[model samples]
Target: MTHRIQLAGHRWVRLVTRLAVVLLLATGGLVTNLASTAQPAYAHAYLVETSPVDGEVLASPPPAVRLRFNEAVSFNERSIQLLDTNAEKLAIGTPGHVDGKANTAQVSLPTDLTEGTYVLAWRVTSADSHVVSGALTFSIGHPSATAAPVEQDAHRAVVVVDAVGRALAFLGMALALGGALFVAVLWPAGRSDRRGRRIVWSGFVVLAAGTVVVLLVQGPYAAGTSLAGVFDPDLLGAALSTRLGHALLTRLVIVLALGVAFGLAVRHGSPPATTGTATTATAGAAGAARRIVLPAVATVGAVALPLTWTLTDHAQTGVQTWLAVPATSLHLLAMALWLGGLITLAACVLVPAGRRETSRAITLEPALPRFSGLAQVCFAVIAATGVYLSWRQVGTWAALGATDFGRLLLGKLAVVLAVVGLAAGARRFVRRRGREPLGVDAAPAAAVRRLRRSVVGEILLGVAVVSITAVLVNTAPARTSYAPPVHTTVPVPAAAAESAAGLQDASIEVNIEPARSGSNVADIYLTGPDGSLVAVPEVSGQLESPDRDVPALPVTVTAAEPGHYVANSMSIPFPGEWVLRLDIRVSDFDETPVRVRFTAR
Candidate 1:
């Protein structure tokens, strides 16, 4: 009788161990699959380049101003505008029209006008529905001004998409990992415990469902489609062609493989006594084989998911470049362990069982210590890696306050802190009570209940963290600037040509040189004759032949130095030849008209 009893006990232990291993495999596979599926969301839209360069001092204004974006922009006239120094409208024809082929916009200006300052104000609605805008200044007859505006729509959209994808990946990982840990520690003793089975199965279902959502949503989000156009094939194809898409595809394959592994484990994990001796032994061995094989496959999948992302997504050069790829990988792994572990604990361990023997001895008692230890290790890994990744991505302390990316990161940190607090409380409760069950005692029941609640809370916060992460990925780093500054020097002559009468014929020489400040601004210098600085006064002047009757446009000239005048706020009225006549008064000469002609084209 003793021999028979021992044999039965050993068989039962084997069956339970097999079930636990299967669950662990499933968890690992699900996390790897989901992690691969997640994509990065951009926060701001990026402008590739522009014409009539920001702050450019053109000899003559072009027919229209053209701006190009990295991605498609929302089409709305109100979104793009042009104004003068006094904030007057200068966009001659229409606000702007999109160039279908280039994915750009063109805003036309009026034909004839006097020299003056002009402002281009633009607002664009990105494919993601976020609105972004900026302003630039340009001058006429002066050096090109470089004053590129700071625009964030395209970049912001990308960041937001990235955050969402990462968060979903994290959430899926947490569910799968937590579920696996529970089954690994508890199911070995309670393979037939209905509640324990439900927990494990439920986690699998949630993980699979989450993975599906990530796969479907990621492609559209990355391509910057409107919410309504998310299902467009062109956008989807474009997204898939990028590195992010390939990573997601790899993740799907891993997840499907894991699902198959889980099914195999469950198939062989029957109650020991339900089958004949020969069948039971065969099933037991098969189950054991699957346990090893599935988890091994899952481990490979996990490694591949992050490795692909590291090689394809992040920048791999500079002082902190070496750390970027490794830190990102570690960050992903830690998140998976923490989230997956919690999910498993809630679904497999803490759930109530029907029979006292099944609940206490088979499920709760054996699983508690194992899960507690695993949770501790996962928490440590998460904390260590999170710190390193945060440091590299965020850089300076001020970035937290100065940039959108940093702010989103800070929000994620807050969520993590809350999860840690809940986890700590659960750990303390588990430690205080020994694994041995108190017969009919409510203390163990209460502790299990508390742990379940804490795990659930952690999952909720994890969701928010993911959302913020998506937003951050789309936005440009706070330190990144798209526009450059403007620089110019204008020299005027000092001598005047006077008639015999009091009236003077002032021959003024206006020297203009336009240079770019940065990527956006155009700096131009305009000097008059008489070897003295001359300003483009806010008055109307006629260009002799081609633009004879055009009114003098508003001009704003700032004195850069003692004898140099920089024209920042001005626009050439026409592109053709024009004779300029400036009326001025020197220290000793009466007011005189200085005439000069230059081709604007």
Candidate 2:
């Protein structure tokens, strides 16, 4: 009889596992299709180059300061400032995008300028709506006697508070959602259990507290001000004016509604009741009213809560956002169900937290099998959504080892795998105990104790996963990890263009790749007076430094296309200002020569 029962159980488990696999595959295919139809977008932008390069010394004040980024940027005019060594702000025009260039910002400066070191601090909003800021120093005439560093203490405090607030909010939501799902769907007895009610209430409190802290910190964070500036009305106004701020405000409102709905759903025998129930002692009409009103309100609040997280985080800005947003929401909901349910199971059923003066009316046997099935379903959804999100966020295998975000994701995956393994072990104990008699015995007691220990271990691993996720959201996506340093562009004067030769009235443009000492490629562009490309029969160049008396290095130029010439190999032995002279022969009869000066260091 025992052998037959074991075989039957094994067959049932096989069927359920197969069904989970099928469901995951179907869902994954649908998400992929949705992503293919969504709009194209990028992640974060990186600053690639800047005008008046950092640590540069200029003889005259530049008319305008410029910044060049790898991805297109939207300037934040209020965050741009030029401060002197004494920390005094200088007069400057409003920053604007350069004509025909979305990736560059230019701001004009006052004509009259004194000699001293100055810091140019700027902040801009990226294409994805994330804020980025940086500072660089340039000396006017000569280095200053005393230069104050850029302010940073305010920024550091904001980062700390934001991180803490985000973590707390996520944890609280998971506990609340998971605990409520467990009580409503699996353990109806939990509706009246004090311990279960407390678990759900705690989640509500933590989430509410976290929301307030985040809202308070947003003001100072955006203004880059000190902690005391959190109350500044202008700073608060800046924070509330953005799309992210609107999402946060909506979250607070959702929390209030959730509290009311949850209170009705959980507090039994009250005029309102959760778990779709009413007080037995109450009159029939009141009981019927309680049954209809409370569950509907609770259901709406539960579904709307996770949507707030989806709108504010990486999902809103990531690639294929149409698919990403829903995938992330489902992932969060599944995680809450799995992790939160495990906690409920351990506390209320498996271990029975309170004193067991006598066996309670509720038994663990009925709840265990139902929880097992629910957990399997939740894990399936999590696994499927996790795979989709990983592909969306970290596109390449190289990024898995190279970027901080990728590494954190890898760590989270490992912990979850361990948790799954422990869960499988507990499931085996359940099956083994099932084959034996139903009453309590030495063997049955041992199995139940071992299963509880495994469940506890899974809960600990779940906490680690949540903590890593909080940090990962703040990190930049790996796609924009590498960027080349900024280089100077020198447009040689047309007066020096050897006129009367075939190359008459032609202009020359030489761009040095990386513009640094060592092997580099020099791309020479030739244009006519009409701004059209001028084809040349022959072109050659040489790199030399008059100050250092460096030996002239010959650079051979090959025609890539009409008016485009490239030198495959141009070697620079040392750092210094190097002059590149391009000799162009438009025809056999005319030879045109032009020269431009640029720094290599």
Candidate 3:
């Protein structure tokens, strides 16, 4: 029996130690990748058109370069750069809106730019506050086969700090909103509990600090600047002009309001009263506050705080946005209340209750029971909203395992399930041990210790949830980010039969790889009706974007194998609907067009 007990104790210790290690590693490691991905920008804002275009051989540098995105984007002077063949940064004009359109940016190119290859590296913040970066190279006179790749992405330190700031903000929000609610409203003796109040107060301070950090870091993150640029006035101004800036500022105001409300709620050291006021006027004032004032402010602040996040994140952009926004807000609120409340409960009530036999024989009574009930409701809301959100963010069943976003979500869910299981066990302990009215305090010391350990596990798991959530929120949704390669066949034009003298039933098989913005490769196979190779005189193509009013870009198709043709350097300008028009010449004078339509990510 002693051996069994000893093994169990060791297991518990190991579990906690492992959790602590995981928390540290995940927080530090995952944040570094926020800005380093190659292309298919983090948010939906994609570059649909570029002046001079990628790979265009020009005799002279254009007076000004223009870029059009599918959606609004925010950038600063440092966001766009001219890089020489050696990956050296060159002088360029400040990036600005084209025709005063937020979706388009224009920059003046130096007329003295020498001949050779040059890369235009651009990093911009989408409306949802995610940074998407890609490089497009255009040659002044001719392409450089040996041109170096652009290494001008956001500095690693900047991305790490930015991610850390975001994580802190998420943690602080939970404490400010959830912790405050627990200290002021959940526990009866919470008002005077120094530790509990301190935790709640610290939450407000951390939240404010975190918000400030993110605000400061935003300037550099969006501009792809070094950490020192965090305080640059111009960078700061550029960041503030964005949608996320507005949201962050609104959040600060709400935090102040909520903090005041929490302070007032706890000011009445003695629990709220009905007959405590001596005079009629004082009584009436107290009654109004108890019934109306505090609740109104607290309610509004709680509801609005989540909106500040939901509105700015990807949540507000997709289908069922009206429903998505509210569901996400509720999901966030429930998370805060449950996590913050649990931490307070453990620290103020359960911890102080003590496992020592000589400790005060306090009845568990209302605090434990009330919180258990609240937790149940929170879990229900979390479950319902979680399901809807999962479906909304990851549309297909295969995506669950196929995409990074889906896999991360699954990891979060696994941790959440573990938390739920622990919470249930704790609930059972509370009900079973508290049945004698003396509460869990009346039960065996071993039972009480078990309860405390279970709560600790739940708390640790909750922190893990928040850390994963920090990374999860920054990533593009699985549905929007996942793009399968384009594969399809288009029928050969009838005009081709008259020249080739074949008859009918022939088709062109088209394949495009990593069909995203930037460099791509496409393979075209001319197959006969009998599924044999059939050589053609020439196969030339151009890409057309039907969704926009832009001109079709030329695509060079070279022969491969007997019947196969390859567009070895196809560059898709953006993520959207596109058509690859292949003009095949069966005979010199007789040619026909074959259009293979597909979507690019």
lDDT of 2 by residue, 1-601 (tens): 4344444434433433343344334334333432443233356555556677655568989898888776566554566789988898887999888895777898998778789888888776554445566776777899787665676334777778877787778788877888877776678688878887788788878887777777778666655666886787776676665544555666666666566556656655533332322222233443443465445545555555666666555676656787888888888888877887888878888774355436574367656777777778888888999999888888888778777888888999999899889978876666666676772222455666777789999989998888887777667765444123223434434443554333356667677765554457878777766677767788888766768534455666899998889987675544557788787675577665666777763
State TM-scores per candidate: 0.55, 0.66, 0.80
Winner on lDDT between 1 and 2 is 2
Q: Model 3: per-residue lDDT, tens digit, 1-601?
A: 4344444434433443343344333322222222122122234576777886766668888898888886777787788888887878889888999877878899998889888888888888886778888877777777777676876567888877776777777788888777777777777777877787899888888888888888898888787778998879988887777767767776777677677667766764322333322333344444465456567667767777777778777776667776887899999999999988888888777774545235444455677888898899999999999999999999888778877889999999999999999999988877887678677667787876788799999999998998888878878788877667778988777778667855267888898987777778999988889998788889899998888765677898899887999999898877778999998888868878888889888
Ranking by lDDT: 3, 2, 1
Query: Against the correct fold, how does model 1 do in TM-score?
Result: 0.55
Model 1: lDDT to the true structure: 0.51
Candidate 3's displacement at residue 579, Å, is 3.7
Residue 93 CA displacement from its true place in model 3, Å = 3.0
